[model samples]
Structure formats: C-alpha cells, structure tokens
Target: MFSIFKTFFWLGWISFGGPAAHIGYFRHTFVDKLGWLDDQEYAQLVALSQFLPGPGSSQVGFAIGYQRQGLLGAILAFIGFTLPSVLIMLCLALLSHKFNQSPLFEGVVHGLKLLAVVVVADATWGMYKSFCKQKLTSGLCLLTAAALLLIPSISTQIILLLFAALIGCKYLASNQSNTHQRFTPSIWPLITFGLLIFALPLMTSGLPLIKLFSDFFQAGSLVFGGGHVVLPLLQNIVGEQISQDAFLTGYAAAQAVPGPMFTFATYIGYQLIPQAPIAGALVATLGVFLPGFLLLLGVLKHWQHLAHVPKVSGALNGVNAAVVGLLLSALYQPVFTSAVLNPSDLVFVLVGFYLLKQLQLPIISIVISFILLGVASNWIV
Candidate 1:
C-alpha cells in the first residue's frame, strides 16, 4: 500500500500532458521498469478505460494498482495519483487571481505539452509494435487512425472500436477449445453505480452538498471521452452557479496542473461551497472519480477471464489495435497540434523524442530539461 501510494503520489506531481501522456508514462514506468504487467495486459487495461465513462488515465492507474494489490491498492492508486491535482485545483479555487493566462504559467504549460507529444509518440510506436503485427490488425490500426483523424468524437471512437471488434470476431479469432468454466464477478460495484445515479438526483433538491455530489457524479458517469470531454459537461452542471469566466479559469488551471485533469471538479466544488471549501473539494473529487473506479471493479475481473476464450481474445486483440490508433490520432490532434506550433517547437519535439527513444534518458531528466528550456525561451522572448 505504501509503495502504491508513494509511487503514484510522486507521479501525481510530474504527470503532465493529460490522459494520453499518462498512458505513455505508465507503460514506461510500470511495464518497462517495474515489470508489473506485460504489454498485452497493459493494452487491455487501456482499451477498457476508453470504453468506460470517466477519466481514462485514472481508471488505468487504478486498474494497475488493483492488479498489483487488489482493492486497497486501487483506492491508494486513485488517491495518490489524483491528490496532487486535486490540491492544485483547490488552491487555484481559493486564490483570488487565476494565473492561467500569466506568462510563467504559459511557459510551464507549454513545456509540459511538448513533453506530452514526446511521451505519446513513444507510447503509440511502442504499442503499435506489440499490438499491430499482422496485416489485418495493422490495417485496422491505420484505418481507425485515419477515420478518427478525419472525424473525432467520443461516439466516433466507440463506434470504431465496436466495428473493430466485429472485424476481430470474423477474421482474427484463433482456433482453440470452446470449453470454458463459468466465472461470476462481484456485482456490488455495478449495483452501487446504478444506485448513485438514480438516488443522488432524488436526494439533491434541498441540500447543497448533495447537489454538488450529484452533479459531479452524473458528469463522471456520463462523460465517455477523456478529461477534455468532461469540461463541457461540468460547464453545464455549473450553469449560473459560477461565473463563466471563473469556470473557464478552472478549465485552464486544470490543464496546467500535473495530475488527472478531472480534478477540475475540485475547483468547481470549492467555488460552489466556499464556506466548507475543503469538504467540498473532497466530496466533489470523490464523487467525480468514484463511479469510474466502481465500474472498473465491476467489470475488470470478468474482462480478465473473458480474455482467455478464443473468440473473445480475438475481439480484445482488435480492441487493443484500435487502442493504438486512438493513441495515434490523439498524439497528433491534441498532443501534437496543440504543442508544436512553429519550427522551434517542432525542433524541440524532435530532439525530445530522440533523447527519450534513442538515447534513453530518464523521463524525469527529460521533463526537467523541457521545463528549463520552455522557461528560458519564455524569458528570452
């Protein structure tokens, strides 16, 4: 438990970029370094998180801890990985001035965004090698990437994944024994998940705390994409309750912070209940994140068992390949286009990539280098 908390705690401080980048960081640290799980297990976990409605990276992190140390590890993982961003968002809420547009903030954020590109590129390439070997799978990967790059949305992603699964069922299934034992998974998490969605709304009329929790829980339960997708849902949830500018500021701050972007809930919670800011932050953060973990718990073990059946395994393979394509489209649109603006930015990414992939510099060293260069360039300008 201590190891789980401590590692994710330190990771919470340095994990910038967002969900795609976090995937890369996790693959590097856990799979490559610690040997926690192999590439196949990691790929399945990523695919599962994408299918689920919540923070993609946080679910993956929680799944990792669960694989390592079960339920307690999952809880510790979520808390440790999420706590730093939650605190940062809370601090931003308490502060009178939002530094989102400040020059220093821009410099730091730019650096992190650049780092995201390098990390995501590495993850995409590495996973491609693992998941997209055969011609059909490779075609699935490239086609999925093309379609998403052309038309991107949560719906688009899900549909493509389903389409890929169909293809996998047809063409990718391996011949094996059909006999398999029945496996029953604990359904309490799924039941609790349904109950909260139904009960929270009914209980929220006169109570601000309940209202706060209900709003976030709904957003967390419904939002299907990554952290960026949650912002609009949260905006609707906070309508007229907080000023538009303040809400926008929290969005910007969430991007600037170093953990799960979902911690934007913490800021909104603090703003919603200034009288009991910390409690608000805790409740809001937990509310937004709890559903995701619960859903993970409910399906994860069953998903693991299903992976062994021949046809089901093929479908997961297709899903895994699609996952890489998702990473590819993400690496370009949000991670690349957002960060690499000019020649200098392009040059920096190339060098950063080379350092990370070819020379194999420690990720932290690369992070510090990016930060230093970004700040220096900002100062020079």
Candidate 2:
C-alpha cells in the first residue's frame, strides 16, 4: 500500500501534459519498467477509463492500483497521484492576487507541451496498432478519428462508441463462448453513486459547500472526452458564483500543472470557501473524483472475465478501436496543435520521439531534455 502511494505520488509530481500523455507515462512505467501489467491489461484499463467519466487518466491510475492491491491501494493511488496538482492549484488560488506567469516559466510550459505531443503521439500510434488490426476494427479506428476531427463534442464521442459497439456485435463478435472466471460484481457502488447524484442537488440549498460539491460532481459525471472537455461545463456551473477572471486563472493553472487537470476543482473549492478553504478544496476534489471511482468499483471486480464473454469481447473490441481513435483525435487537436506552433517546435517533438522510441530512454530523461530546450530557447531569444 505504501509503495503504491509512493510510486503514484512520484508520478503525480512529474506527469505533465494531460490525460493522454499521462497514459503514455503510465504505460512506460507500469507496463514496461515494473512489469506490473502487460500491454493488454493496460489497454483494458485504458478502455475502461474511456467508458467511465471523471478524470480519465486518474481513474486509470486508480484502477491500476486496485488491480495491484485492492480498494485501499486505489484510494492511496488517487490521493498520491492527485496531491501534487491539488497543492499547486490550492497555492494558485491563494496567490491569485498576483497570478501573472513569468516569461521563463511560460517557456518551460511551452517545452512541456511539446513533450506532451511526443508522448501522446506515441501512445496513440501504439494503441492504434494494437487495437485496430482487423479490417472492420481498422476502419472503425480511422472513421472514428475522422468523425471526431469533424465533430468534436462529448455527444459525438459517446455516439461513436455506441456505434462501434453495435458494429462489433454484428460483425466482430466470435462464435465460441468462454468464461475465464466467474466473479460477481458488487452492486452497492452503483447504488451509492445513484443515490448521491440524486441527493446532492437537494442538499445544496442548505450549505454552500454542498452546492460547490454538487456542481463539481455534476461536471465530473457528465464529462465524456476526458479532462479538457470538463472546462466548459465547470464554467457554466460556477460562472455565476465566481468571477470569470478567477475561473480563467484556475483554468490556466490546471493547464500549467502536472498530473490531473481535474484538480481545477481544488482551486475552485478553495475559492468558494473563505472561512474553511482547505476543507472546501478537499470536499470539491472528492466530489469531482467520487463518481468515476464508484462506477469503476462497480465494474472492475468482474471486468477481466466480463471481457472474456463472447458478446462482451466483441463489444470490447469495438470499444477498444474507438478508444484508439478518440486518443488519436486528442493527440492531434489539443496535444499537437496546442504544442507544435512552428518548425522548431516540430523538431523538438521529433527528437523527443526518437529518444523515447528507438533509444528506449528513461521518460525522466525526456522530461529534463524538453525542459532544458524550453529554458535554452528563452535565453537564446
């Protein structure tokens, strides 16, 4: 349990970029380095994360911990992986009075963004090859990516996934039936999740903290396309209560920080409570993360065998292909477009990719290299 916390705590501090990039770091560390999980197991977890809400990468991390050491390990993993950004965002909330970023700092962030591109590209391509092997699945991967590039909405993502599942059921499902293990899923997690979603809104009128938690919980539950997609919904829920500038400040800080972008809730929670800011921050953070964890708990115990079911394996195949597409789209839009502005930025990404892939270097080496490039660019110009 302590080891799980320490490992993820280290990851939280250094896991920059965003959810997809975080996936890359996780694959390299857990799958490749530690041999804690094989590539197929990791991919199944990623697919599960995509199906559920909350912070996609964070849920994956929690599930990974659960796989290793059960529920306590999952909690420790969430706390460890989320603590760094939670602290950073809390500090930013406190320092919002003078929250302007320095040019050198911005340059460092720019270089980190370029590193994000390299990581996302690697993860996306690698998953594509793994999941989209057959003709139908391959077409699903490309078509899903193409569709998302055209219509990049949360609804589109859900619809694409459903469509892929249907197609897989019809065309991709196997004739043979096999059950690897007969594990029964616990239903209390689902029941608790339902009760809260229905109950939280009603309690909101009595307490400001209740309202804050309720709003963030709703945002967490509704999001489908990972952390970035939660921003607009969060702004809508908190817009009247908080200033636009404060909201944007939190948004900026979320982008700049490592680990999960969902920690934007930490900043908002602190801002919402003047008297007990830390308590509010913790509450809000819990609110935002709780739904996904509940859903995960509901599914995870039996998921390994569920995927082995004939019909489910088919649907899982389609979902896996769609997930690859979703990741590939994310890599291009937010990860690539946001990072690579000019030819020089492209050069950095290419070199970083080479170092990561061919040379098989440590991810920390890539991180340090990228940060130095950004700092050097600041001094040179």
Q: Which candidate is the best by lDDT?
A: 1
Q: Model 1 residue 311 lDDT?
A: 84
**Mind giving the per-residue lDDT tens digits that candidate 2 earns over 42-158?**
888888887788788999999999999999999999999999999888888888856447777777888888988988888888887788889989999988999999998888888
Runs in model 2 with CA error above 4 Å?
Answer: 97-100, 180-184
Model 2: residue 40 alpha-carbon error in angstroms: 2.0
Write the residue-wise lDDT of candidate 1 on 1-381 in tens digits: 799999899889888888988999899889887899999999999988988999999999999999999899998998899989987887788774756667887888888788889988989999999999999899989988999999998889999999998899788887876558555667999899999999779988788888889889999998788888888888888889889988888888888889899898998888888789898888898889888888889889777667777888889889899999999998998889988887888889999999998899987899999998787777777
Off by over 4 Å in 1: 176-179
Error of 1 at 238 (Å): 1.3
Clashes of each: 0, 0
